[model samples]
Target: MEFSHRDDHNNLSLTRFESMLKTNNVLFFDSNEFENIIQHYLENGKIALAKKAIKMGLQQHPSSTNLRLYKTEICILENDLEKAEEILDELYELEPSNEEIYIQKASILSKKDQHQQAINALMIALEFTEDQDDDADLFSLIGMEYLFLEKYADALSYFEKCLEIDMHDYSALYNIIFCFDYLNKNKEAINFLNNYLDENPYCEVAWHQLGLQFTSLKEWKKALAAFDFAIISDDTFVGAYLEKGKVLEKLKCYNEAIEFYEMTLTLDEPTSFALLRIGHCHEKMGNLDLAVDFYYKTVHEDPLLDKGWIAITKFYNRSKNYQKALYYINKAINIDCENVAYWKLYAVINHRLNFLEEAEVGYKKSLDYGNYELETWISRADILTNLGEYEASIINLMQAAEFYPENAEIEYRLAGLNFMVQQNEKGIFHLKNGVLINQEYQFIIKELFPSITELQAVKNIIAVTEKS
Candidate 1:
């Protein structure tokens, strides 16, 4: 049976149905009805209800273009591009001229892996004009879409087009600076910014860009002057104060940087990145205990920030507090176990704490997840050798040597392991190569080659290699 709901004033009986669903804990709308409900809910800014209704609709109309568009919107909101792209292909076919449909499709494409094609589509969309008047005007929209796709050169082209039409287009002007920064065209960016600032000296955004550009060029003193102008333009500009602190830090003005960061915290909730920077400055200034405290608070304030956790872990490791290092590294792993750096760090802390078995597992996990580091391989081999797994250690060391054959230290280490296992011929081969590569270690040659009583042969090999 098709359930038709209506109430007074010809309104769809949505309020009555929703009220009943809430009070009785009932699921009222099926796919078609739920989609209609979501369209009405979205118009009224009831986004959460709209989301729930769309989800319900998707269950029944999984392939419906209209329902799929709604579902795609939800996915975009949730930052799930994969699911959004799956739904978008069908949606685009149903509404080819729909600007929002094309824009959303391009966004999903950019997120999913075809950034260049997505940028081309957005630029093509600019050729077709629309009646809607928005701050992200058509050209500005195309420029931003290019920015999101990381086609900074194309983005600059579009933004410049917008500025040619309206020089006071602040959004396009701001985006132009961002594009310039990304392209490393700082000189042109500075010239454009200086002109903008001359016309509108109170533009905090332009001033901030100018300051950051100066900072990038390592003109710290000039960067400070620009940042000061930004703050003067708008005392409430949080980014100005934060950036000024970074410039001061670069100039080795730690106390001043701390004061600026502290001032930023007074304006708003302390940013975890800023807190970590402050902690680093304090650590550089020999206030280790205060640095630790700041780092701890940074992690507590924003547990999701990887840098905060990393800062705390490094602090503990530097202080030789093995337990704290283990604690922070484990916490980071719990949050993002798939990250190779986190797993590597976990392995290092485990190894430092003598958790040999766990460290080995962590190292293997790190390598499996694509962590390729010379140090990690060397350390893992050393651990395996210490655990009496000679074959595994030799295999790992050999693989490492393939990538870094010229590393004398690694060659020497592998030779020692081979000699320990009574592979005298192999040990002598690598040892001679190692000494040839780095004759500074010639003093240890006799001791390493005690079994090879024929020093004349070893000397002959070294002489031939050095001549070659």
Candidate 2:
């Protein structure tokens, strides 16, 4: 049946079945009609009616293989895997060549989380199926099973087979790209998409995926050309427009980027991501007023979008408006205190405003939330040192050294902290380590440890390490 007429056909079958139900009269229908009626009810989620149709179908066509398979399908739907397996076993012995018997077995095994077993069943189904479309579906199913096993290369191979059988399989195309991305095969993905587009020239999805692969390789002009083709193929492709805007931004065409972003707002619902990008473009072009306006709109449009909140906070922070910056960052933290970046910025803002205690608390919160950036570790150590907690400063820098082993800045700071507490031997050890790693960072002592800059032991270690 043609797709356009399938609903009409199903409706006619449904009407006849419903009429038979109302009149309490037995109606004569071929096994095909009975299967259609059962399938239509099942598709419409009328399970009780589907079961009624199934019972009627079996009574009328007792030996119909397809109708009996529908019974196995219903059992699978109800998650009665044991019964489904038993039915499959009977069908297997009676009609070993029936592909659907194995397909149904795959479904039952999939429901039990036995993905490898499901794959084995689908492989058997593939061997018995002669229809090209049926083969494509089996390959797609096998690809999904491999995905569940996290075997991207195996999934990619099967999904590739799906496209080879039917180039119009968009789901298979997308899965192919997903597998390629997971495997970091961007160059291969580019080559594959280029080959596909040669035969299927107007495939908008292929063009869009090609653009994404080019973007990953930082081939900005190629990415722009691919997105342009995608937009030409389908002007209403909102994702293509958004991605093109990002490429334009990377190329420093801020005005052009803004225009593409605005086009998405007209084409679909106004998205916070588009609004945020528009705000950033304006900020880059020095349109401060327009920038802040769009930033505010972004947050108002989607308060849950943490990026929008951060943009607003950064805008105020850059303008040297500490009070407003603090207010916005506090709101962001209130929304998602678990975000380490938000807490890190909150700490910096509080420190600038001389709220040392609150800065200390914010830095600690950031660290607790998994902020392991070099600056965060260094800044927290600085905050402790300024608060006269020399021992805490030393301990904090010690943890930082584990992540950045042999880092000169960390060693320099450690030396300063040790010397501050009169631990001369430990101080000399770190000082030599710092100087040996990078003598260029020697100015750090003048900036952060000015009092220890002239210590004889510190100078001796620096000189000895420099000579060595």
Candidate 3:
């Protein structure tokens, strides 16, 4: 009821402000009224109208400090930091104890990337802040400055202080969790949050953070319990439901996870993420038809969600329906041409269908788009070898070798390619190094070139290496 009244008042003010604008009667507005009008425009990002309002405001009340302060705010938004600081300095002189001047100074300093100076200004603002509720905001600002400086420990301390003042400060709680994650202090976070929950067991945000911390530690049961408590505290919390589903999925309880994911749909509109997870759970449970249905629903709801398309394509590939896989993957590629995973999948499907040239092109595209997976390089090299372009295959493997110097599979493949080109000495060198580095990878040679293993020289090399 109170919120509705405030909304009605704001609407009435906006209507009067617009009527005055249409008639050029804004001059009739007093200084306070003009300030309100300008603030409404500024808050809504109508910078031109805000400037117009400020002009009229200053013309009517040139001595108004509030109007001048709004001008400083406008200057700051425009990135005219020097002008903003000049006005702020004058405002500070006029209102020496005003907390807002210090906050404006902090904003300018933060924009300049002088985080420590911004923090100092906020500290000064804190001295003038009388409201305990405002102290939570001040602490959050100081925490944000420390975060910008990459001082995760300091940021966590300040965010914890903010949470102490207002336990319901969800943003501060999330920041504290982020800081803990950044520091790899999950165990510490669990202990600290457990202690906090001892006194405030009903803090849904704290319980949610504890669940996330347990998730990071792979303690699925504990994470599930934390999420359950969060849901108990606030049954409408969609985040808790989603996270509970994830923990169930992690535990390989697909049916239970699907129930939780479906619970979210009851509380809110079906999200693409929830739909995708339901599809994945069904897929894992061998309900391919149901999985495909949900996957199609996901894409229909959010056509631009590449994961949905990729999921459908991968399902087809797993079922060995190469043609359908190719068709859907092409659709995904059309949606996001720069996605390396899509290109990689495109290459794999093409390779399965024996479209060697197309597969090579897709592999090149994947690599060009920064696909660094070792399998991508190896698959491309294998295609080149199949085309009997042994020299090209060798060159490709050499680049892969540069990226993964200690990879035994790459070394073995290089040895095979060199042998195909009759580089006997080079083949012997790499073959020796590959077997010595990882003897298990000798199976790759058996799979790729069984006839070569029968060679007496190769057998001698293998025998000697095995003995070593």
Candidate 4:
């Protein structure tokens, strides 16, 4: 805030000073002075005051381009990009010769997700640039804009142009690598990176990128060596540990993967993905309790992590704890109710628990949402049978058999259930078909339908004995 005395020594008074202060309201300060005050407010972490000062400065000096620019920056900081664009539009028209205004407009457009329009504005900024010295910065910024748009070819061209203007620009070099990777030109990427490494061997990012490329090529040993070099360059590189763990997982070295994942977690905040992978490794090693523990930890940390819920539910089901299986399955469904797999798991656990009604509802929900698999139909049949709806169960089995004609297990289960409830003709037909499909039916044939042969062979003798 600036104050210039209003009058001569005889008239200088407290009342006059106060009146000047109230009317001027810091407006007497030049653009640079106001900007300094704004910057001081920002540096002191008084963001709202800084914004208010910027707005006051812009209102006081409506034609002051710098003041308007600062106000536009404040609008961007407050995430009111639409207002920023409106300011930029007026500024661009007033100062068409000022390339900075165009650049600011491009930035505001990019923030609003209008990337292509931002690029065109940047091109226009370049076309009317009276000063040649600022072209490199402008080109580099445009390259970044293209990169964000995923227009890799154009990004590469602009990045290369920036390097031609300033040969040692790090941003241009990094953008070149990114563009090559985006275009899947791995050979060129490797060449560029190798050259970069020759000049800068301690670059951890270069080593990590090389490791990723090796992993993509399935050269696991080389990938491991590259990641080791990366870790040596920067032991704190979390990405190196994570990528190494993933490569180990791909090589089927699950124990090594778990170790790497654990180390990565130590370097960064533990993620649900890492925890889930640890659970998977333990499950593969047959450490069921450890697997369940990790999965539970993951779910507790992030209830929206549907995979952890699925993993724990599968573990409980595998252990035949149908009640616990049902619990986690419902938790998963609650988190992602639209997912068919969660519903299927819920149905399966319910069926195992003999909660026939609940199981039927879950299976039907799954079928309605997703593809109807043979197992879903089979489970539907089993649930119906358990509910004493034998006819409905047989109907589902008949439909499932059409889809899985060679599934002798389906036929056997259907026949066994029919025989259990005294549906003799249907039981005989299915059992005979099951035997035709699998000749091993004789092993339990008599036990399954006890009266079929015994009653046929002894009915007359039993009748005579009863009469005598």
Best by lDDT: 2
RMSD of each: 7.1, 4.9, 3.7, 11.0
Tell how far residue 54 is off in model 4, in angstroms. Answer: 2.1
Question: Which scores higher on lDDT, 1 or 3?
Answer: 3
The per-model lDDT (C-alpha) reads: 0.77, 0.92, 0.88, 0.77
| Model 3 agreement with the true structure over 1-468: per-residue lDDT tens digits | 111355776566657767877995643567877777787777677899988878878888988888988999999999999999898888888898888898889999999999999999999999999998878888999999999999999999999999899877779878988998899989998988898889889988889889988898888889999999999999999999999999999888999999999999999999999999999999999999999999999999898888999999999999999999999999988889998889999999999999998998899899899987898899999899788888988888898888889789998888777777778789888898898789889987788766678766678888987787
Point out where model 3 deviates above 4 Å: 1-13, 389-395, 406-408, 411-468
After aligning candidate 1 to the native by TM-score, how far in Å is the CA of 254 from where it should be? 2.0
True-structure RMSD for candidate 2: 4.9
16-114 per-residue lDDT for model 1 (tens digits): 547755775655455556666777777777788878777666666776667777778778877888878766766667766656666677677666667
With a 3 Å backbone cut-off (N, CA, C), the pairs that clash in candidate 4 are none
Q: Better model by TM-score, 1 or 3?
A: 3
Q: Candidate 4 residues 1-468, lDDT tens each?
A: 222354333133323333544785443555665666666567667787677667666667668888888788778877898888898888878888777788888888888888888888888889878765578888888888888888899999988788677655767877887898789887787777788678778878878888877887788898898898899999989888888988888888999999988987888889888888898888888887888889988998788877888889888898898888887788788778998888988887887787789989898888788747987987787678657787777777777788788676677666666766676666666655666676555444344334443443223333443455
Which stretches of model 2 miss by more than 4 angstroms? 1-117, 148-153, 182-187, 421-425, 442-446, 450-463, 466-468
Per-candidate clash tally: 0, 0, 0, 0
Clashing pairs in 2: none
Q: Each candidate's TM vs. the true structure?
A: 0.69, 0.78, 0.85, 0.64
